[model samples]
Target: MSKVPANEDFYKVHLLNEWSWKLTTPLDAQPHTIDGNHIFEVIFEGNNTDTVCANDGHVELKFAISAMEQRNPRMPRLKFVRGLSTQFEFAMASLHTNFIRGRFGLQLLFVSNESVIPGEDFRLESLFSINDEVTPGIFEMVNIKLGERDNSTTSTLKSHSNTPQSSWPTGFIQARPVCYTSERYREVKASRDAKLSKQRTVLNTSDQELLLPRTLPYLFYAQRIKPTDDPHEVVGMRLQNISFGTPGDGYYAHSSFIVWTISFGFGEPPIDTLSPLLIGLITLSAVVVLGSLLFGTMLILIFQRRYRFGEFQRLTETDTTSAVST
Candidate 1:
């Protein structure tokens, strides 16, 4: 197929660096790690083949992860997936997320791409499947106020993170990868490993606590959702400094590519400005009310001044003096 000429028809998510994913079969017992001999490179954009993807009049971005699996790490521009020229659409139609609109969907599918050899140089297998259900955080518009604190019907996890969600500006969303599970453990695993997963991280986000009468029962944290230039533009997410383990945390502390789901806050972008017609109407109403009050007050004061000055003459006094002669 000819290359789709690069244009603004879609947005490209550029990464700071190349990231890789490795899996160990029988990860608990006899371990054999398969690095896949490929660096992961993916592109994202709105699925606009049929018209711009939209939802309830707002633009909905259905970004698909097109993984360009390469056999040689040095061949950065190599575009090959399962021996095909095009990259595999790993998680396109199925955008998996748990928290948004109090609903969730299984928007992901991946089966092992068997290598020519079983353990050595294994290439990951993939299938592009759809589940018909609307994928959570797949560019759905949300309009919840800062604390939706009165949201009892919302899930317990709707407010589970340590970030001050109440202070999260409008159009901010956490495209949290709810969970990563493998029917067979030989491939994918949870991004968070043994220690960090269980680690009780309690950030001191007492800024809101200062506004409260007393302390709140919540931990404080940051970086739960990545910030954006257009806070109300309803953007998805991309990560920098990707790694399996940090120099401090050591290797296997985390999996870089597992949680790389690019979903955005599902909500209505803020309507900061009122319509011009509405504003004009409001100004007119205010002027009319003020004018009526001022006019009434002036009339009342004038009447009081005349009456106090004894300016009222009786009707019988209006008769002319010539009436005496008649």
Candidate 2:
């Protein structure tokens, strides 16, 4: 048997990042059906070849809901299950009592224990992976605004400190690792210990905290689903507002990579409707056109008045000259 080339290996690993999934509800079909017992199915299909290997690799699925009473829970309700093999179903009846008329955020995350080996590096880049691409923040203190807080009270805070304490952004809750095997767990422990051992000096409490590593357990892929045309539909309820990424962070450091939005409760996926961004663009174009017309009319009036005034001055000069000659 011939050994696979490096390029071929890279291609195989790249396929793992190319996987995608979709959400379909009964409301999506023709003659839409939506009730209290409605079910939302996620169809995940992807090519996973043998060349892509991780020690304890698996995928996870999560669904987050936001509505009136429980609006903006610190952490979303999560479901961890084997991903990319088959269709997964979530019965709305099991999760909610009456019917949840709110926005749904569906996320898929990939977790693996393949990075513990020292000197043996695994390429961390993925379509869904979120990490700093350039130099990390240079400043010790960064000023940020938390939700609805007075701008005057906003203060400069440290990004990461060597102290015993740390501050997370608003609405962010700490989470523990969810999926892993015993062997992987041991390896992670060993690797963490080895890394910490190198820093032997007993420095200040802040210095110790600064030496700690920030570990992101999962890399995510996400989508937002909004309500459909029908008001009675159980799925695709109206969304007040939806947002992706973390506040003050340029990218979604802990959140999922948002792909796009999907609509349900309609017969067919309606044409990608105009977005608020598009509407704003159209309004701006109209304003510019009207402003240009008004400016042009004003310029024309000014030019006409100047021409008449010059003609009157010329006529007055000619009359004065004739009088002088007489």
Candidate 3:
């Protein structure tokens, strides 16, 4: 295959550092059907093309990214580099708190063509066979809000993490590898093992607690759909669904690549119950209504004053004319 050109079509750029890891098995995005306060489902279909290789299998997992934002006011944005890539790996599992579990062996595929070309948006498609081996795992989709007294980032992560693993609303447990076996597949495994070990150090840290609240219940779509036009890219997610964090409680909102969307708040609330977004909307509407009424009253008073002055002038002129005639 010829080298894919970096052109206007790409909207995102993958800044891979020296320590970055890549996934050999590609993922596809499934369609979005259900909407809830704290749960989402994205199904992906995996594919395995190469044959006659040893590592033949299909696998899938439930993945989610913590929404982290910058502390600088002028530069509020989502931070994708956690010394980790945004792609979720499902194989080398070490239990994560709550419902989500991550594998140390997953790699992410980034877009070569960044342009937002129609039918060209990066997508996740169905995962399929690798070397004819079957992968395992049941994936459940869930959205979680922060708990009381939590930061936007922390609240979001805890909301999801608090859910019992046994209660994973949706996820995958795969026994088969989701890719085709190739002669060079062994190298991929070795690289994955090393990467997983390193990531384990980071994933097991307290810094993994940031999250934006408006996008609360961060939705995870299963990896089943792939970008149709470019194998270099996949399209399935509706970028329009991206939203800013609720600004009601002095929270700021913004967008970022790798994580796509994120939001922040000043302090933590009963995230599980506090709907700052809803409260904010109500407050804004009330302000607008009140302002409109005040403005309308002021306009009416001004017009009434003008009308009365004109009438008084007319009466005075009539009296003067009558006196003069008499």
Number of the top lDDT candidate: 1
Better model by lDDT: candidate 1 vs candidate 2: 1
TM-score of each: 0.21, 0.25, 0.20
lDDT of 2 by residue, 223-309 (tens): 111122322221111101122322233322212122222111111111123447657887899999999999999999999999888
Show model 2 residue runs off by greater than 4 Å.
Answer: 1-53, 60-268, 314-326
Order of models, best lDDT first? 1, 3, 2
Give the per-residue lDDT digits (tens) of candidate 1, residues 1-326: 01224773432222111222233223253223324444334333333322212321111121222233432221011123332222222222222222222111212111111101111211111212222122322212222222222213331223344875444333211222222222122122332221112111111224223321221211212222223243222111111111122233223212212222322122322222334765778799999999999999999999999888797666564474435543
Q: What is the lDDT of residue 228 in candidate 3?
A: 41
Stretches off by above 4 angstroms in model 1 are 1-171, 174-271, 311-326
Instruction: Report the lDDT of model 3 for residue 216.
Output: 21
Error of 1 at 298 (Å): 1.7
- What root-mean-square deviation over C-alphas does model 1 reach? 25.2
**What is the lDDT, from 0 to 100, of the residue 283 in candidate 2?**
89
lDDT of every model, 2 decimals = 0.27, 0.25, 0.25
> What lDDT score is found at residue 108 in candidate 1?
19
Minimum summed lDDT over a 10-residue window in model 1 is located at 109-118
The prediction achieving the highest TM-score against the true structure is: 2
Worst 10 residues of 2 by lDDT: 191-200
Candidate 2 global lDDT:
0.25
